[model samples]
Target: MNLSTQQKLEQALQRLAPIHLQVIDDSHLHAGHAGNTGGGHFSVFIVSDAFAGLSLIKRHRLVYDAAAELLPSAIHALSIQAKTPDELK
Candidate 1:
């Protein structure tokens, strides 16, 4: 994976004002799958105020909006587990 992804992730977190953010590249797990040739798929654990009062769907949408440009290109799959810090505990 390139630093650009991390930078992009950070930017997204900044936009969301996340209390906690974890980004794990799962591309190796999908090495043979389509869109896996590029460095993209990831599992994200995010705790952010942007998700605090939102429904699960909304939370996902927010994250999706943050990385909208990466979809189907720089990022193919994102296994997102969005939560608030309190919700996580």
Candidate 2:
């Protein structure tokens, strides 16, 4: 079975136990752009306790690590907004 990029991202990010998660596909917005052969562009908004006390870079690192296998292939680029639940309140 084949999984869509959004599905793949959701599955991979599950380890974070996010209180809220949203994956937006922005491929259409970049259509015809150079370097966009087949891979998709995405934006992720995730709220999880896992981000507590972590710096922005560290939070982004966690997100990148989870989605490492998809980089430059299934996913060409990613924009992430990772925040702790407390930070949202």
Candidate 3:
């Protein structure tokens, strides 16, 4: 069986070896939007040491790269919150 978008996100982002990761699927909330189609809407909260010294833009870029195959395809939207363990305190 094919994996869901949420599952794919989790698997892809695992490359960063997050200390904590949460993925929320919000596709149902965009039922009628043109971009909705079969693609999914999601938000991710991830804490990882990999993000330790990166700037906000770079951090987002890292995440984007991680999910590169899903963008504008299986995933219509993604809201990400990337942080380090210390930042979570």
Candidate 4:
């Protein structure tokens, strides 16, 4: 029925077929902040072949496009580290 923000994010990112993926909820770190209303802050660490040949901005764009529906509501801020598997070697 209802999924947590992390779950939702993970589900959304699955489209990338990541070799490794981690979603960290950083909402608590910004607790009581002025701009924080109900949305959560998150960090994403992902490794996927999809990132190969893509620039940093393009990689982030892909991530953002996947999670577009959650922005400014289910997700307030997102920090992403996207890398290709080869880059990890």
Reference-based TM-score of each model? 0.83, 0.94, 0.91, 0.95
Stretches of candidate 2 off by over 4 Å are none
Candidate numbers sorted by lDDT from highest down: 4, 2, 3, 1
Better of 1 and 2 by lDDT: 2
Candidate 2: lDDT over CA atoms?
0.93
| Per-residue accuracy of model 4 over 1-89 as CA lDDT, tens digit each | 98999999999999999999999999999888887868999999999999999999999999999999899789989999999999999
lDDT of each: 0.80, 0.93, 0.91, 0.95
Top of the candidates by lDDT = 4
Q: Count the backbone clashes (under 3 Å) in each candidate.
A: 0, 0, 0, 0
lDDT of 1 at 72: 63
Residue 37, model 4, lDDT: 64
List RMSD in Å for every model shown. 2.5, 1.0, 1.3, 0.9
lDDT of 1 by residue, 1-89 (tens): 55677578657667888888889877778887753647577898898867777899999999889988777677878888999888977
In candidate 2, the residue pairs with backbone N, CA or C atoms under 3 Å apart (3 or more residues apart, or in different chains) clash, namely none
lDDT per residue, candidate 3, 1-89, as tens digits? Answer: 89987998899999999999999998888877874657789989999999999999999999999999998788888898999999978
lDDT of 2 by residue, 1-87 (tens): 999999999999999999999999999999889878688999999999999999999999999999988886899889999999998
Error of 2 at 75 (Å): 0.5
> Using alpha carbons, what is the TM-score of model 4?
0.95
Residue 81, model 4: Cα distance from true site in angstroms: 0.2
**What ranking of all candidate models by TM-score puts the best one first?**
4, 2, 3, 1
